[model samples]
Target: MSTMPTLDTPVTLTISPDGGIDGRSRRYEKFLGDMAGVYRDAEAWQAAVSARGADELVYWVDDHRYQEGPGALIVGTSTLLPGRIGDEFAVTRGHLHAIADRAELYHCLSGHGVMLLETVDGQSMAVELTPGKAVNVPGHWIHRSVNVGDEPFVTLFCYAADAGQDYALIADAGGMKSLVVADGDGWMLTPNPDHTGYRKA
Candidate 1:
């Protein structure tokens, strides 16, 4: 548990009408889809990308990358774009911590979604989230979130900055071994064939 700092100089965060974090945020427009580079579906994927706009804004990362000694903490909120990649919902580019023993925490601020977690040791899980919910991400887990609601999904996070992220691992693996998708009125989990070489749970 970390305490809020008593600052001589007050730092402020402002949220725009569209949920953007003022001054301290980055946006990603080229988010890879699950079908990206699937040779068989290249045409379909290309059409979708063209129709939807290839550089559609995927997510907004707002953070105060503050260092407190050798150990540091990052406070931020990720606002996920609302839409689907084929049948799958839009998701964050997930990552595993470079420092395998480090953990992270997330608190849902608004909208609805699911958080996916996996480990090198063959463990995997998905937790649903909504406003006001908090989740503790244990060490050694690779994690990401998917927006399942109609509106933009947003969540606040606090994590060890020392636990640098290794995104290449997940990208090289073609993303998580499972995915959450729209199933009728709700959503369901489905295995990602691209990740067949990896274990799920």
Candidate 2:
């Protein structure tokens, strides 16, 4: 009988702070049109689609997934281009890990941003990150990346390989519990009126 394949060998990854890895297994891109219904300002998003063209690149992720199972890890970089839609800044689609209890770590590679976090139980937090800063996001939290600066918000992230993202959770709840908006020269978190609270899976 044929033998099962052996496990993967350890490898060195040359990661770039600007959002890339030398041995990335895949790259995913999100365009302006792909973000419909994500921002609270519907009118602004529509106007942006008209002015910038629907296919404009909004963000991209490069990741390396070497294995699968309980102990495997997925490493990657997220690059979010800076922009504004109404009073809100550019943000990732956001998600809750499918496993629910899987945690994550994000290290700021460049630019200024915020890690917007919220829990199903009404807990909310916004942690600002500059180059060299990092956030260890605990499990059970809904998280997203917000770009609050003029440069691309880039971050290096790693999480359990089995921690698949539930992208529809936020959409089902009518958006997250808070919105990150401009506060003069800074940024602030305001309640999202449309949020209907999270529904347990």
Top candidate, metric lDDT: 2
Model 2 spans with C-alpha error above 4 angstroms: 1-5
TM-score of each: 0.81, 0.96
lDDT of 1 at 190: 83
Give, for candidate 1, the lowest lDDT window spanning 10 residues.
Answer: 32-41
* Candidate 2, residue 143: how far the Cα is off, in Å: 0.3
**TM match of model 1 to true structure:** 0.81
Error of model 2, residue 98, in angstroms: 0.3
Residues 55-106, candidate 2: write the lDDT tens digits.
9999999999988898899999999999999999999999999999999999
Q: CA lDDT, every prediction?
A: 0.73, 0.95
Report the C-alpha lDDT of model 1 over 119-200, residue by residue, as the tens digit: 8766778999998787899988889888999988888887887888887677567667787878997899888777744333
